[model samples]
Target: MSAEIILKANHISKNFGLTHALKDISIQIERGEIIGLIGENGSGKSTFSSIISGVYPATSGTLELKGQPYKPSDTMDAQRCGISMVAQEMGTLPGIGVADNIFLGREEKFTKYGIVNRKEMYQEAAKAMEVVGVAGINPADPISRYSLEERKLIEVVRALYSEPEIFIVDETTTALSQKGRDIIYKILRRLQEQDKSVLFISHDLEELMTVCSKLIILRDGVFIEELEQKDFEEERIKELMVGRKLTGDYYRSDYDGNFGEEVVLKAENVHIKQVLEGVSLELHKGEILGIGGLTDCGMHELGRVLFGIEKPVYGEAVLGNGEVIHSPKQAIKNKIGYVSKNRDQEALILSASIMDNMVLPSLSKISSAGLIFKGAEKKFTARQVDGLSIKCREITQDVKDLSGGNKQKVVFGKWLANESEIFILDCPTRGIDIGVKAFMYQLMYQLKKENKSIIMISEELPELIGMSDRIMILRKGRVQKIFERSPKLSESVIIKEMV
Candidate 1:
């Protein structure tokens, strides 16, 4: 017997002002199947998913849910019709309790005579979180108390609470660590076992291959091709998505791990409460120092402490010039830059224009006698935008409107324009596509050649091996080992130290 079709999207097209976000596209989701959506940034992967989830109405198209005409006015309407989505961006709201975020719009169920039953809602919310294997999150606590990864899992709980037949995950896994990813994987498998459907959107091709049974490819808002599990090939999928064969090295070609003897940035016996304990490291000029560990292994905290975002309880991070770093403002003034792992919240001002964000770090350089120059600002912003190939209508466009890759470019461009000598990049390439990842790696290589220093903190072991001159493995608020860069450095060796 043939499998039942759960949802059908026909001749879908979407537009925003003069820009065509998605062209004519048609796809279907089948019961008991996992479908992967693959494409580069701004390729309409999220747009299509948004149309189905009722976040945006299609400019033209028709949708059939279980062979019935489905027109959802909003996300809640879609949820009522057994459709749910976990957005790529942060979806939970601050200044609210975890239980309130879980049952955002559907709080009517817990309403008794116009008074919300807080006790009953918290119980249900706790149960929902438990179902997703997320522990230690109190439903009564404010959502702001949790980290980005935990909040992502909370969004998962919210989506799963609806028990929708069609579950859409839009680049949500990129923000999660291995433990969090395993929880999502388990949820997807359980949904498949129950004869439900999933639409998995991701930039990680290897991850898609592992979790999805079939893959749909899109390029420049057009449907290019689709592939089954048996026909899946990395190069072929990349070609189909980008419309060209990717050439050149994906990472640094040389195995030589030589770096300057001069220490540019040093963390001297730094400690951050429970996060980092006696973490000491040296970032030399013209070096890419990769720090790797599990999600809560304290490497990220080390990065923040080094960048002066978090103060160490005991030791300090100092520069070769004997400048003591005490705050972010002082660090920036001393030619140090930081790219946060939580890009949206910490790196870029989403509401501001690209020009504003790009010129923020260089405002003093472009200003004279307490006066700002629009000409200088435009010139600076224009140079970075063109050099980085940041796709946008204009520099005046809002940063939030750009794709994830372009947003990251803006973050990089700001620091580059400021001429920062030392960079602390945390998860720099997260949620971006392969093409962009390659570009970022090349950029780092160029920075190294210019004698700039870098401290790259990441959760991915392969990236740590691929880019760093030396790899430092942290486990439970302590450095387990530091391995020099060599051709024979394998993930297995690094994993041993990290665990």
Candidate 2:
């Protein structure tokens, strides 16, 4: 608590048009401390982070760095002042090698007379990779060759190579697996030991409580409270973040009733290449069935197969009333919704408006007798926007400009409008705030109440334990064990089965 204050934000405020994004917020970041910036979706956290990281200039405020007034004009300016940020959406250049991406703009260090010094670049890249706990990635290899988790590591490495004194991490852990997160923690601990400052942002309260010494709460562009480590509680933090006390567990399901006589979805001996070997599963009405294992354990392949995204060599999925779907188009026509693990790639149409995206799934429904009903479409879109609590000035606004949580809600809304009987959600709440996560869980419970069966595929053990009425653990594409909810599953037990 006696640590030196490295950065101070005094009465910071910003506005977009007539809307206030930040309303007179003040906070101090101390050296060697891990501080968490907590808030709901669109609750000024991103705006505040952007202000500090030089993505935007504060309308009225003063930012002091080590007791000296600092105003950064751009990201490069912020970096020059010893401040750097690594945002959640991994922004590594796909076509370039790791070394090239690391020293992207500042290639002069690895250049001589306009010629790149490839040898020096590789050495620096290797050192940066090691510092960030990524050693297996080859400096010469293109970034496109890496996975999402691997690209996440590259972003961290890029920042480390820039030599930042105050590191701003914005929800970086949501993309990472538990093991990948552990590696990040190690790097943060090392930075803390060296008396460097870190502002950690994440939706996982448990992880934040374990790491952050101080927590700042935000609500609707207003600074609500700042709590010490002693005051940290899961319910308390969540309530503060959303300005309300949430009911039920982190995941909600009513386990008292049967799964129903009607089969909403049936995967009959589905196989995709050699990864899936005659895998079959049945999901009934009003059920939340979870599937989990390692990333490469064939769990993902199963979702793709069921959704008709993957071309199966053998077997098929049958909808309610015995309608077979051989492709995604057929599945869509059958009224089945799928949310992929890769939100950026598979789920969202980034360039389209939130309204356009939301109404996409139900275009046919809105079209009447070969005539498009625009008014009816707007009515449907409005209902979805309000139901999901999607934050945007208008449905006409591009989804690309919205926060990570809002983008996900748009994807959900797009599917929900179609009146889909079955839902397949793969890591639906990844890379978002806790308040948004709670909302996602609440939405799922609401859907369950409507007799909509869901298949949740996730790599997170706690999420599976929290939400699923029934859980299936797969190992090497084989169903190892299935656990029912009444038994009250534990993380350790599930993890043991997974390994």
Candidate 3:
């Protein structure tokens, strides 16, 4: 690893409207270093990286690359200056081939007489895929043909193809499985070995500790502290990020497996063609039944099937009152709720207001015989916004403008407002900070106490082990094993069945 400084930010700051997204921040990335950026959502990690990589110009201050003033007008400009960023959100364009998505914005390289050469693009894409250790994706297939995780891998390949001197991974790992994560970790290590710099942003502290040589902490868009690898401690990092000591058990303490005798929801040999095969499970009242699996292990699909978003070809999802879940409207009418793994796409209306999203699902309850009461809707939305402690300028603030954690809280708020009895949550805590995650755990326990059945589908093993009464491990679209949660239950025991 070289000690040569590759990128430097001198007192950079950013503002959107009247909101200061980043304060007077200054930082550096040396060659061959993997620096971890940690903070709660909207704490300026992405803003700082964006300014450095030229997604947009900073409001104030300057940046230097290898001792030269670096002011890129756009992402392509940054790319020309040897900087590439894998965004936290899905960056792949739909309807285009995988190769096309990988080489997007650089199609001129493949141009021959004003036409792209398909053969050469495929060859280059395959090489990039091989270098990134990504396989099972055909470059000829449309980008939309792949899952989010697969799309994220394609984005990884795209960023790696440039082989930039400064590579910024902005919260991309949360979308990946263990295999995908390992591939990225390997790439980060290889970058370090080649004396290139990597700016890694992740909500997973354990992953940061494993891969980062140094860690930088940010709070409310201000630089807080920097720690060497030896100073890495999960609790201390959480404290600094939150700016307060979190004093409590992180997960639920009670491990009693005693749940309601009645099954609130049951999947009787539910099948989703190629995705899910003969998956059967029972969710009892007042229980958090966790589903743990690999990314493609059909756990996400199970949530869809149960919530009537996707119809099962073979079997049925029966509710407590013997009502079958045939469509999402039917599921909603029957008091069943679902929080999708894809929060932006499936759960919340990003362009809509917080009040709009919170009141959307409860319109049926808040409406009169022939008209909707606007004041009642506001009251209802405000109650949930306050209850969830969602950080926003106002209830009318756009959901898209809020942080990832606050957006997730809005998802929960909408469901909680609807007062759903059975909840199917897929990756509920994905890409959230430790403080929000702890609050979510406590909320789940509160729901469990209220006798609301929850079916949690997650790729995270620790969360499943920590909060579940019983965990179902899925492998290849089938239930491989089921473990009853106890004081003795550990991640190793659940992981044994997951793999």
Candidate 4:
């Protein structure tokens, strides 16, 4: 039986001045089939999608939709062609409710005499939620009250409401819970029934395997292989994405951790009201401590509080080695580094140049005798950039212009340049490509080799299990379980404690 082709991208390539983002990428997505786009960070999945959806026009290529030549000059044009992309980043107004966000531009359709038909919109939203199998969220409640995952769901519902013939979802599921992801799978199943196509992107290859029909692997901004389900293997996929056979699992020391004399971190009976309890934990030198649990578990709060971005009403974190970092500024001054899960929010200063961002943490460190030393600063950042292999045309490029993976590398550079001994990383590889993730893992390992301690907070059980030397599962602002080392680590083990 011949499959119906919904979209074809032929010889698609995009370049940002000297940096070639996409290279003659060609792909055929069949009608009603889910195509998985896989690549390492800066490998060009998003760029390809951007070119197809008119976020940016292709440098040179042809995009055919339903056997008709299609060139989306803008996002609105893409929408008109029944091709819509739900960006991983939420652009929702914090004051607006889910219903309004879902139907923002099309609110005029539900209006009567130029007045909003709120009740009708709510009813329609309820039906849409029902279709998408989401619950517990009030359409009337302000979007600000929602969790990161809930906001992501709202974004999904918003994009899906347009009934796009071809839907592009980029790295969205990491924010959603198991139940929420199931809802998305159900929605995609429904879309499949309607003969709609989807370009599904995620770092979770295992999850993609369950949902996508074929996996198109990209490397160095080029399409390398289109792997059929029959040929799908985790090791093979990882190898293809990284362009090398991985050595082991790319985690820290697999053996039981050998505790050092110095204390790296200490939090004493910290309280954050309803969100976080009187939590206390101590970290040692050269250790990678893992944190995980359900979405409501106080792990995120704990990270924030320890970092001093969120103040605690009670308790204090005493650094084991006497580094006074009670406030965020103090924390930065004391050489503590942080990479947030919400990449766009806490980590990136999008409007700033890459070099500026890379030195943001170490600005004071780079200056000497009350003078800005450009040469020394450049030398410091250049070394880290080379070590991290930052994928940018130049350090002067805006951090916003870099891909998710490269942007993250810049965040790492900012911290690494500070020569921080203690690092806090939250979902560091969330939206990046496998290659970039591999590099991040290697970087983490390298940091450990440098005898630096790290605290890794994540929702993905695999990364936590595959990486951390110590595992701590937080449940309802309390430590449910803390495994001393990799001697006892598994997704099932962590999941058992996390919930």
Kindly report which residue stretches of model 2 are placed more than 4 angstroms away from their true locations once superposed. Answer: 247-253, 270-278, 312-325, 368-376
lDDT on C-alpha atoms for all candidate structures: 0.93, 0.85, 0.90, 0.82
Output the worst ten-in-a-row residue range by lDDT, candidate 3: 490-499
Can you write out model 1's per-residue Cα lDDT over 1-499, one digit (the tens) per residue? 9799989989999998888889999998889999999999999999999999999899998999999999899999999999999998899999999999999999999998999999999999999999889999999999999989999999999999999999999999999988889999999999999999999999989999999999999998999998989999999999998899999888999889989999998999988888888989889999999998889999888888887888889999998887878889999999899999999999999999999999998899999898998898899899999999999999999999888989999999999999999999999999898889999999999999999999999887778889999998889999899999999999888887877
Screening candidate 2 with a backbone cut-off below 3 angstroms (N, C-alpha, C), the clashing residue pairs are none
Q: In candidate 1, what residue range of length 10 has the lowest lDDT sum?
A: 457-466
CA deviation > 4 Å runs, candidate 1: none
On lDDT, the leading prediction is 1
lDDT of 2 at 236: 89
**After aligning candidate 4 to the native by TM-score, how far in Å is the CA of 462 from where it should be?**
3.4
Candidate 3 C-alpha lDDT tens digits along 413-486: 98899999988999999999888999999999999999999999988888898999999998988999999989
Regions of candidate 4 where Cα sits further than 4 Å from its true position: 94-97, 111-119, 321-325, 373-376, 486-488
Query: Per-prediction TM-score, please?
Result: 0.98, 0.93, 0.96, 0.92
lDDT of 4: 0.82
Clash total of candidate 3: 0
